[model samples]
Target: MTERISDFAAIAGRYALRQPLRIELEETGMNNTTRMIYAGEERYVLRVYDNHRDREIAGTEHAILSELQRADLSFRVPAPVSNRDGATITEAPDGKLAAVFGYIAGQRPSPESGAHVEGLGRAAGELTLALAALNPDARLAPAYKPYYDFENTHAAMNEASVKTLCESSPKLAEQAAKAASLLETRRRLTALTERFKELPQQWIHGDIVFANALADGDAIAGLLDFEFCAVDARAMEPAVVLAEFPGEDDALAMNRMRRFCRGYGSKAGLGADEIRLLPDLMQLRLMDVWLHFAGRLAEGLDPERVWLRETERVSFACGWIDRHRRQLDVLFAAMAERQAAI
Candidate 1:
């Protein structure tokens, strides 16, 4: 890590900083190489693009954050700290695109913390409301491709990938078969694409998993990591957050989802069509995860031994979601109604 830190000395030099800059590697997401930098009394985050694809998206995220800062959002979001040359993104000696941001202080929430869950939901709602005011075309520097796009979903579920995924594990194979059947019987693929097209599109923080959110007691102190941000169907913002709610228990998970939807609806109220499509959107989210993990297993990339556990989680969640579809629809509908009345 120290060796990698040294490579960014030139990039760090571009920033107007106090003497004796200290760099420490941050162990977080798999996508980016993040470092915490201390320059005298001030702290900041330096992120180096790990993949080529992310390099293209960096400018859009910086622009989006800049816009969010101007909005005076209630929660803390990363503010781009431009270098001495006034460039938010600087090319490193190694050719990786790097950017600096003012550090936000908070801890990642524990799965068992109820306050954290509610706080996350509230923060998500507030963030969505704030983002809704921004026009995607005005803020995004380079166009972004959404990970949750129905076209991507179709490609992931194509026959070849499905076969490979099913062949990787017997347990997953059964689940894959079920998922494929559900896709057809539910008319999920066509319905989602059509509905998504009809719904309003907006710039969204596409990845709002727990790791990406920071909490202070019962409040969300910071919303971190906007690498997956994009302009997409508005419902996807809340759907992604709800899908990633931390828990292994089905009842608890459903309760958490209900709380999240309620929180979101309170601020950025869902439309009648969006409310009706909520259940399917969530199912799409789960199916997306299912395909992602299954693809990883098929590719034999379980270096961390997390794929099996993730696969099990996705499989069970999909089945559970299918069984309780009617209940989820009712819950979301009620939330929308309450919001409308308010």
Candidate 2:
């Protein structure tokens, strides 16, 4: 087993003049391994990316944070700490990619808390509004698309890796086909990007799962992790918010969904069409999740640590499709309402 903290400290010591007095790893995030490092009076976050690609990804994250901060957005993001050479990237003892962030203090809201639900919604809404305020023409690399890419998701599931899952479990195949068909319609609609009225697109945090957020009381204390940030549809953020919740019942999931939309509307303001597209977008997001984990498994990566309840993920996906089928119709209805309202 890899000792995460000691690994982090060893990485930190190489970059900073003083080694951390203590390094505590936060184990909740799905992708990156995070550690809270206490060095002198300041607290910093040490993160190791799951993929060891080039340092350009890190640079993109750094740029996104700077832009968000510069734009004076409504939340907190990691601010990279510069070393003596005024550079954020530092070679660790283990020679893996590493960077540190200023730590902001806050607690994640319990899943059962109504306040937590509202906070999650509001934070997402505010982020969407803030992001929309930026220049849509802003340039960003394409690596950020996989998480929110509706088209790529359609391709992934029908492709070889995930198709094997469908073949292994006939029920899974049936459920996947139904889900994929709905997503296909959404994909076709989204492709006419020029035809649909374009909302202002700017830098968006590609991944906003539960762990990326922090809350104190009913308000978001901080919004951390921008490693997957890129320029994309304004709709992607709220779509992700809907995808994160794994409630046992559609009622509870809808409750959370409603709260999230209301909160986002508080800041960003959602139209009827946006609300309608959300359900399709939500399904699109789930398809992405399936492909994401499937891609990992196909690549021979162990998913024991990735899914919170590993064995149940497939069942949950199937259940979600079954329960939300009615809601899918509702989404289309909402879209029509949006067109009329507009």
Candidate 3:
């Protein structure tokens, strides 16, 4: 892997270039390249956008973070660092959008701790309330589409596309055939399209999985990676989070989900309608992953291991969610009752 440090040299020049600069590349984040920069006593993260490579989108995220930094939240949100020019955004040598954020103090959370899972849910709830309070430009929302548009957003992810992918290699055929599950998810979400509009809409941190939620002790302290933030169904916030905890099977994850919903409800209450749609919204989140991974595999950007895991994830989670619909409704209703909003 090319360090590409030299490519970022121009952008890095904007910040205080302390002697013997040290930049370490991170191993995570599929859509963006991240580097940790140590400048004297201060540590910061430099992210180069690979998903859209659009400066406006980066600006939108920075704007959102700026507003969130001032919001009435208990935890921390990443604040973009301004350069010498009093600007948060700068372009790298490759013309990709890049920005530096003061490194938040925390570690990746583990699912073993029920408090941690619950804390992440609480963080999700807090963030949901914060995003709902923001009144940014209406244009900032349209660029980032909701997860419900899984099919159109990824035009080539249809059944025929996956069939072509399956025929491409004998080894991929079995795993690749699972794309049908995504098609099914889209169908379900499609049937509820009108109802979704009737519920509510707001700016949301569309991706709130463990990788993006940082933990200080047993509770989530900071939220990272707003690159996927967008306007979507209000419930998409928690659904995005719940979709990530489908451990081994559904049993372990449901226990965690219970605690999560409790913690979340304590901060922000869910409406009766949102509660009813939680299962489908969670399934929507899964198919969104499916579409993303399938899009990557089709483009030759990733191997089958990448897409197969997502396909298998969708299959397991959606199946389990379908089997436990009544249980989900009950759990969400309990969550709404526990909310501080009520």
Candidate 4:
């Protein structure tokens, strides 16, 4: 990592940018190495893709942003800066794909701030609406595995390899047990998957956690990171957002969830059926997270301690969602009714 930062001079020239006075590593996000580049009086974000194959994902992201730039949305998004050859991505000496983007100015929201939570909800809603306007294209199709798919969850839960991986941690073991019991019920899972298949499909920002949102005071100034962008179920977008937003308590979390749904309702109204299916979709999102970590553990990439923390968090969230399922149904129903009236 030290060597990569020191070699920024050669890399920066590829994008027609001057040598950086300083290159500070932005040590956030698990997937990529990002750096803040200071070149003379200008600033930009330099992202080094984790794998060479990520170039396709980068190309798709660039296209999505290009389309979004035309929309009159409220929040700003990262715009890809092209190299001298008009290519958005360039290869480094190590065969990794990298790109520079026009810097988006703002900071991530404070975890304890209710106003920031609401702003994030509204920003996600606005982005969803804007993305809806841009017609779906083949480039937006997911290049990686579909983590949110129920069939994927079903397979992962049943795998002996995954079971062996879970045995290493008590939390994962318990989650595995719970998954088995839930699958035994079977009817709900089957119905939920069927309903999910019926929901509208479109290109969505696959990851919309707080870290990807930039806030200025109480408002969302920009939405960053579109590398996970893909064509998927529309409900999955709000489901992911609601799962990620921070809330101090169940009451606060419920309120935040309602606000998010309302914000999304304002632009693209949820169907009554879609409203009814939101809880299941939310549960599915949590399960998706669980499976992702389990996969990481199985691959020997995640530490048992870290995997335990993630598994426990997902397990607790699933239970909480189950307890408040009825309340969420009522809130989403009201939102759908209001949208119908509008």
Q: What is the TM-score of each candidate against the true structure?
A: 0.88, 0.77, 0.93, 0.90
Cα lDDT of model 1 by residue, 81-117, tens digit: 8889888988887888898899888889755677777
Ranking of all predicted structures according to TM-score, beginning with the best and ending with the worst: 3, 4, 1, 2
Query: 229 in model 1: Cα distance from truth in Å?
Result: 1.3
Compared with the true structure, all predictions reach lDDT values of 0.73, 0.62, 0.80, 0.73
Candidate 1: Cα lDDT at 200:
77
2 or 3, greater by TM-score: 3
Regions of candidate 1 where Cα sits further than 4 Å from its true position? 53-56, 138-142, 153-157, 168-187, 245-248, 294-306
Residue 38 of model 2: what lDDT? 77
lDDT of 3 by residue, 42-102 (tens): 7888888887777778888988998888888878889999988888988788878889898
A best-first ranking of the candidates according to their lDDT comes to: 3, 4, 1, 2
Residues 1-342, model 2: lDDT tens digits:
365556776677756545436777565366666777777787788877767646777776776666667655556767888865677876664667778888877887655777777677677766766666555333335445533454554454444544465455544455565444534544554564443235435667766766777777666778887777767666767777666665677677666665655565555655555555555455555656655665565465744344223324534654575578677456434434543454
Model 2 has an lDDT value of 0.62
- Which regions of candidate 2 are displaced past 4 Å? 1-10, 14-20, 26-28, 133-142, 146-157, 165-200, 303-342
lDDT of 3: 0.80
Of candidates 2 and 1, the better by TM-score: 1
- What CA root-mean-square deviation does each model show from the true structure? 2.9, 4.8, 2.1, 2.7
Which candidate should be chosen as best, given TM-score against the real structure?
3
